[model samples]
Target: MTAALDAIDRAIVVATQDGLPLVDRPYHEVARQVGISPDEVMNRMDRLLHEGAIRRIGVVPNHYALGYRFNGMTVWDVADEHIAEAGKRVGDLDFVSHCYHRPRHLPDWPYSLFAMIHAKEKAQADSLAERIACVLGDLSRGHLVLFSSRILKKTGLRL
Candidate 1:
C-alpha cells in the first residue's frame, strides 16, 4: 500500500527529489526550503523511509564523469530455484553497480538476472564480466554482455 503523505511530507519530497543541495548540512538546506525545522525534516525523512514513501536517500553518481566509460549490462540465464541466491551473490561483487531479476522471454531471450558493470576500459569491463561468471558458475546457463554505445539522460522522479 502507498503511504499517505501529508503536506509537509510532499513539500519535503519536492524539495529533495532532484537531489539535496550540495551543502555541508543538506537536510538543513531542505528544511529551509520546506519551511520546517531540521530535526523535523530528518524525523519525517526517517519516517518516510520506514513507511516506504521514499525508497532511498543517497547520491546517484555519474559513472562517465568518474572515468568509468565502459558500461555493460550483463544478462544471465539463471535457474529459477537459484535466482534469489544468484542475485545476492552477483550484487555482492565489488564491480557490479546494480543487480536484479528480469522476467525472461522464452526461446528468444532466456536471461533473467541482470547486472550492470562499469569499467574504465573495454578490457576491464570484460574482466568484470568474467568475475561475475565465476560467481555464477553452474547456476548461470548462459550470459551476454551488452555494452552501451551511448548514454541516455537520467533524471530523478518528480513529485
Candidate 2:
C-alpha cells in the first residue's frame, strides 16, 4: 500500500491537482506554492513514486484544444486468463494513450480491458479501435466504444 501523505506532501498534491505550471521551472513553482525548496519538491515526488504514492509525474496536454476532438474509452470483453497479455498488446499501440485490465460487471457490463484512444475525429478513433480488435484477435469476445461529450472533472491522484 502507499504511504500516508504528510501535510507537505498533501499540499503538493493539492497545488498540482489541476496541473503543474507551464513555466520552465514547474517544480520550483510548486515548491514556491508549498513553501518548500525546489529540491525538497523533487525529493518528495521521488519518494511518492518510490513509495507507490504516485506512479509518475508528467505533462498532460489539452487534447481537445490541440485538435484531438475525438477521444474514446474502448472496452473489451476478453477471456479473464488472457486479458493480461491482450491488454499489454493494446497498451503498446501508438494510438492507445492508456490501457489496462479491469474487473467485469457481469450481466450488463462484461468488459475486462479498457483502452483510451485519441483522434481528430470519430472515424479515426473507430479505425484505431479496429486496429485494437485486430491485435486482440480471438482473445476478445466483444467490444464497445464510450465517448465523452465534454470535460467533466480531470485530476490525478489525490492524497
**Against the unseen true structure, what C-alpha lDDT does each candidate score?**
0.92, 0.89
lDDT per residue as tens, model 2, 1-159: 367889999898888777788889999999999999999998998998799777677767778889998888999999989988998899999888899888998899999899999899889999999999999999999999998789766676564
- RMSD, every candidate, angstroms: 1.4, 2.4
Any idea how many clashes model 2 has? Answer: 0
lDDT by residue (1-159, candidate 1, tens digit) is: 257999999999999888889999999999999999999999999999888888888878888889988999999999889999999999998878899998999999999999999999999999999999999899999999998889788786788
Q: Residue 143 lDDT in model 1?
A: 98
Model 2 residue 123 CA deviation (Å) reads 1.8
lDDT score, candidate 1, position 8: 99
Number of clashing pairs per prediction, in order = 0, 0
Looking at model 2, residue 116 earns an lDDT score of 95
What's the CA error at residue 111 for candidate 2, in Å? 1.8
**For residue 33, what is the lDDT in candidate 2?**
95
The regions of model 2 sitting more than 4 angstroms off are 1-7, 156-159
* Backbone clashes in model 2, listed as residue pairs: none
